[model samples]
Target chain A: MELGPHILLALLESAVSTAVLALTAIGLALVFGIMRVVNVAHGEFFMLGAVLAWWITDQLTAFSPAVGFAVALVLSPLLVGAIAYASDRIVINRVDYDPERTIVATVGLLYIFQQISLMTFGPDARPVEPPFNTRLAIPWLEITEQGWAVYWPWGLSITSYKLAVIAISIVLLIGVWLVLSKTRYGLIMRATQQDKDIAQAFGIRIERVYGLVFAAGGALAAMGAVLIVPIQQAHYLMGGDPLLLSFIVVILGGLGSLSGTLVAAAIIGLSNGMIAVFFSPTLAKILATLLVALVLIWRPAGLFTRSSR
Target chain B: MLELSGIAAAYGRVKVLHDVSLSVCEGEVVCVLGRNGAGKTSTMKAIMGLLPLSAGQITVDGTRLDTLPVDHVAKHRVAYTPQGRRLFPELTVRENLEIGLMARGEDSRVLDWVLELFPRLEERMNQLAHTLSGGEQQMAAIGRALCINPRFLLLDEPTEGLQPSIVALIQEVVSTLSKSGVGVLLVEQRIDAVLSIADKVAFIENGYSREVVPAATLKTDRSLLEKYVGV
Candidate 1:
């Protein structure tokens, strides 16, 4: 393939990755931004979604793949959100949301979730069939003897399902933005984020807000996982890579900034895809880590943060 | 009436407010005058249930405020503007006021009253709280407290770090609210400013209420201010 088509394929792949990554990282951003607690188990919520999607689709074998996928898409995030809410009330709230203690608590949660998935879902990597995947040949522009012409390029195409994932993620992200900006609930959450004691003084039930935020964060991660499960297998250990990537994205984007998270996801996702296509996946990971290190050393607060908070 | 009787509170093992007693009847402005570290802010916090009371009780119109959770205290038609304005910095002034309104479950109609009280705030309503000038921030804070349309308002150093014009405006607002039948508990260091608007003055020293006297008596005798607040 020519370099143009190769780069185009890489860009397309990056867009897919960026869409899913933004969904996952926004949840982490909201939790940290509002609750002021590090949720190490965030990626586990993503894994749970993927695993649940596999299970739900398996149980609905009598139905069509599209029906099973639709049901799993709705059920997986709800189930994951419930689990997250329970953990928030049972463990996180009990810890008084102390930063250090919550980190340790969430790390424990991470292990528990991983173990549960390993025990119940088995150690094998399971795949869920996509609802619909139709590949269309991509045309490349070329200068012929007569004039500029468009011709179908060999091995240059994208699946309809990937395009759908991109569209769905865009809609969901817009929805999240609307909820945070236009609604009264968003005002309360933003107020709580700015000052917990002051918000409490203003009669905001912060504990309830914290619980809901935790559940929403987990649900967003699960939603991201469900979208990507058809392309990536549901493995018990798949949570680790996403967790690391999200942490990097959150930090690079500026902790607790939704817009920053999206921008950083795009940067990191595109670079990861480009590097993986041209070089190696391991090199892409190494370079991404190096980029984070450089960002921390230079701009410790983050690239998008206005002040040194 | 909003009453704090023998309210003793501590921060962990260190006692801050001991034997502080004061009250504000409807249409009264009661100022708590104290020097730095005299537990004036602590007294306000205790009344707002921000700090746990080791002993004594805080009641608003016969309802026990101390027993209620910190967030629930605002539901009793009591609003507190703590020291330093404490507005949600990133949020717009309108949002800050809206949050206060939300506390009492008041409609947007109450916001019109607040905006009228601080008309300067109306111009700066869309600006972020942190970006406002000190006077404007104070106005936003006071306006936010008023958004709840509270029966009693607790203000800690509302005039602190403000210009004379702004301070006078705050005094006028206090008197206006008092005239509207809202009990006001003000913690202030400026004796003259407090005396101008306060109906009663309670002096706090070393975490204890030293004396409670009529504002006219304190104004006539500067000796009490020099003795308790060391002005």
Candidate 2:
């Protein structure tokens, strides 16, 4: 493949990847933003999303792929959010703001969920086929109904579904920003994040707000999974990589800042894609981690923390 | 509008409030005076339902408050400003005030009144709470609480760690609230500030509440504060 065309393809792929990663990291950031709990098992929540999507597709085999995609996009996140809410209330709430206990509890949830995924899904990779993967093309690129490009300026291009996923990520990010900025709910969320005790003193039902926040975060992670499953293929262990990437996003963007998370995701995505084209994927990942570590050593609080609490 | 009777509270067997009793009628400013560990805050916490009372009862406007949760209590027209001007340090000043209005619901008009009272908040509405000076942040905290539009207000050490001007500003707000028919229960370390504004004064010490009397009588009896509140 010629380098120019290949480079364009890589950048396109990187842009889509960054969008997906940003969507995933935004969920993590939302949870951390309000609760200040790292939710170490957040990756497990991501895995659950993929598994749920796959299960829904299998159960609704008679439905159109678009219907399956739509259903999965909405339901997967809701399911994960419900589970996150229940788990937070039942388990995390009991710890009473003990950070060490929260870390341990979430880690336990991670392994427990991982084991469940293994048992239920049989430890094998499965492809999530949604009807959206039909076909469309742009001059040099071939796009499927699902949004994956089979052929592009370079060669075989990215998936249409992944590109759609990127589009959705941008929309969802904007939607969340509006909710946090313009709505009364957003005000309460910001207030609680700043000082939970003070929020309670002001008479806000902080517990309900927390449940909503956790659910929202879970839903976001699941939505990201729904978008990515077609491109990445669904598996029990699919969440770990995204989880790692999200952690990197948090560190690179500065923890709990949504704008920073999106920007960092873009940086990671572009660097990973372009560097992989020139060198090896593994080398690119190492460079990403190294860059993240260097940024942390310099800033510690991430790149754009604005004193939330 | 607010009443506490024989309230007893403890944290893991260490009782902080013992058989405390107090009441505040509408348009009244009642001050609870005590030293650092004199259970003054515990009284406010008990009223706000933050501390579970081991015994006795609490009521506001004749409705029992002991059974309600903290948020529900606020819904019943009770508002509280905790000690230390506990503003949400992360949020902008406007967002902090907005949360108070959100919690109270239907009384959002109070936000405008509070902004009128603390005009500094108007200029710095977009700034983060943490960025504000101690006095400005304290004003924001009080404004946030007042935005709830409570019939009964519970203020715990509202004037702590601030300049004299800010202290005067707070006292004026409390006095204005009282005159406007809002019942206020305050805890203050500064005896003169409390005496100046309080309609009635109750001395809390050694985990018990002594007889509450007119602020005028307590002002003349400085020896009483020396014996109980210890300055």
Measured by TM-score, the strongest candidate is 1
Worst 10 residues of 2 chain A by lDDT: A134-143
Residue A155, model 1: lDDT of 94
Share of the reference A-B contacts seen in candidate 1: 0.90
Question: Model 2, B77-171: lDDT tens per residue?
Answer: 78888888778876889888877787767454678899889988999999988899989988998887788887888888888898999999999
- Give TM-scores for every candidate, taking all chains together and pairing residue i with residue i: 0.98, 0.87
RMSD (CA, Å), candidate 2 to true, equals: 5.1
lDDT of 1 by residue, B1-231 (tens): 898899999999999998998889989999998888899999998888889999999998889999998899889889999899999998999899999999989988889988888899989989999899999999999999999899999999999999999998899999999999999999887888888899999989999998999999976788988998787
DockQ-derived CAPRI band for the predicted complex in model 1: high
Each prediction's interface RMSD? 0.7, 1.6
For each candidate, the DockQ is 0.89, 0.60
lDDT of 2 at B175: 87
Question: Over the stretch A1-309, how does candidate 2's per-residue lDDT look in tens digits?
Answer: 666567777887788778878878988898887888888888888899999888888777898878887888888889999998998898888886467898899899888888988998788887888556544333354458988564545253656666677788889889989998888888788877877766776777888888889888878888888887877778888888888889999888888888899888988888988898788989988998998889878888887775334
